[model samples]
Target: MKLQQLMSQTRRAIDDYGMIHTGDKIAIGISGGKDSLTLLYALHGLQRFYPEKFDLEAITVDLGNPDFDLSHIRHLCETMQIPYTVVKTEIAQIVFEERKEKNPCSLCAKMRKGALNDAVKKLGCNKIAYAHHKDDIVETMMMSLIYEGHFYSFPPITHLDRTNLTVIRPLMYVSEADVKGFCRKYQLPVVKSPCPADGYTKRQYVKDLLRKLNLENPGVKERMFSAIINGNISDWTPRIR
Candidate 1:
């Protein structure tokens, strides 16, 4: 997908959820993955023309993995004139070495997001943007259903009262396939994840299962996404245009 197309979808989600406001500073959580990088590019592009003015900052929580590099990411942010900050933490050690939890994803994510949220709050950002796309939304819903016995997924916007920060997912309308295409076309500096549980998580299982189900029953993903927005689950309802 081209930058124009990405921006179009991102803008729709932003507007639909009332995500941004004039003079609002938004922080983008950079995981050094394609989804987050695509979000960075999309939001940067949208900033150029979107009527509601906002500032963008990129923040990454460094899990203290030796293989994880941020030099390329720093260069990308510098080239785009966006402020970038990486919070260094020994989360990898704590989760893998010290705690040694069998299911490390939960603990690791909590630590990572805690770090990210702290950094974002320090930066005076009222809202933080995550790169959860259409596929992620569907996968999360399926995971909740299969594991927690609930037909639910995260909302596009969530207010974390504890942190006093509102989380926004502007890429909710963009698909993972389009994210890959945009990254490839724009030659984004994609960084490979060094986490040990990269592909061994329950989400990955659900992702594969959803892919197979989609193949067997075409348009299932789209219908599921449509159902999410119209399902009246929490704040999934879209704003009237």
Candidate 2:
């Protein structure tokens, strides 16, 4: 998708779910990946003319991997004039080496988020933007069902009472295919994940399964997404404008 198309879908999602507010400071969690970079571009473009004025801060939680490079990401941020920060941590060594976790995604994610939240708080951001697209939402629901025997997925907006911070997913309406297309078309400085278990997790299995299901049963993914929207699962329902 082109930038114009991405911004249009992103603005619609933001408006439909009341994701943004006046004078809000949102921290975009950058993983140097396509999803997050696409989010970065979308928000930056939206900030230009959205009725509600808000500030954007780009942040990445470095997982202490030597092979994980952020030079290109930093340059992108510099060129875009978005304030960027990278929080360095030993999460990589702790999760893979020290802990020797067979399933490290869970622990790695926890540590990464914890670090990112702390940095965001220090930056005085009231909200955080996560680049979780439509496929992520559906895949997460499937994972919950198959692994935990429940039908659940994360909401577009979530308020954390403990931290007094809100998390918003602005890319909830955009598909993974569109995200890849946007990145490719824009030639985004996408960074490869250095994690050993990038594609060997249960989530990966569910993603593959979902793809097969969608192929055999057309519109299955859309129906599942519709169910989540209308299922009254937590705050999954879109807010009325």
Candidate 3:
């Protein structure tokens, strides 16, 4: 049931967003974390029987952290029979030194994504996928509304205006809990970000708050997800993927 839900949600997101087309090659960005790992698994499953066939390449952006390893990721990709590419980038040092801020989350994320996009393009993929899930969408909506003085969140599909490349978030409708469960069930080898910041950053703060709220009101995150998906802010348009 869990796997079905995960796959169903992902396929619906992909079909609804037109993320991939016949004969197109896509880059699935796997960070070796649970979310990205699950994304690869889901895509691998989809590739098994997708009528409109497409090629998928699993790519990981190595942050040049000493603790980072592509061995486990490589094995998983080989087990799934998908090719893997690792991009070497000094993102950790760059963000730590050049980003003179109390928190380097924003800059680090941007740099990592930019590096991944560039690498994917060079690797012959015009479409890229990220492993952002339901919780991420809700948290981003909350952050935008509370901090940015407006309501906004990541879209299911969009073209990076500057690069004219398409980005897809197939896990948009799936929950992070489901992802963790799926990873455990499959015994997927997981990797962690080896930095002091690790997963204890500001996003975790919001996630913790949401978790506590969920204890009292389990409907909170669901409501947030619905609002983001069903609510409209303005006439701001989106370019189709």
Q: Judging by lDDT against the true structure, name the best candidate.
A: 2
Scored by lDDT, model 3 comes in at 0.83
Which of 1 and 3 is ahead in TM-score? 1
Worst 10 residues of 3 by lDDT: 232-241
Instruction: State model 2's lDDT.
Output: 0.94
For candidate 1, the 10 contiguous residues with the lowest summed lDDT are 232-241
Clashes of each: 0, 0, 0
State the lDDT of candidate 3 residue by residue for 1-241, as single tens digits. 2667778888888887677688878899888889998998888888878777889999888888898877988987898899898999998888776665568787888988899889888888878998999999988877777678788887887688887688889899889888888988878889877766877776787788889998999698998888877786453234244
Question: What's the best-to-worst order under lDDT?
Answer: 2, 1, 3
> How displaced is residue 124 in candidate 1, in Å?
0.7
Model 1 regions more than 4 Å off: none
RMSD each, Å: 0.9, 0.9, 2.4
Global lDDT of each model? 0.94, 0.94, 0.83
Report the C-alpha lDDT of model 2 over 1-241, residue by residue, as the tens digit.
8898999999999999999999999999999999999999999999999999999999999999998889999999999899999999999999999999998998999999999999999999999999999999999999999989998999999998878999999999999999999999889999999999998999899999999999999999999999998898966755777
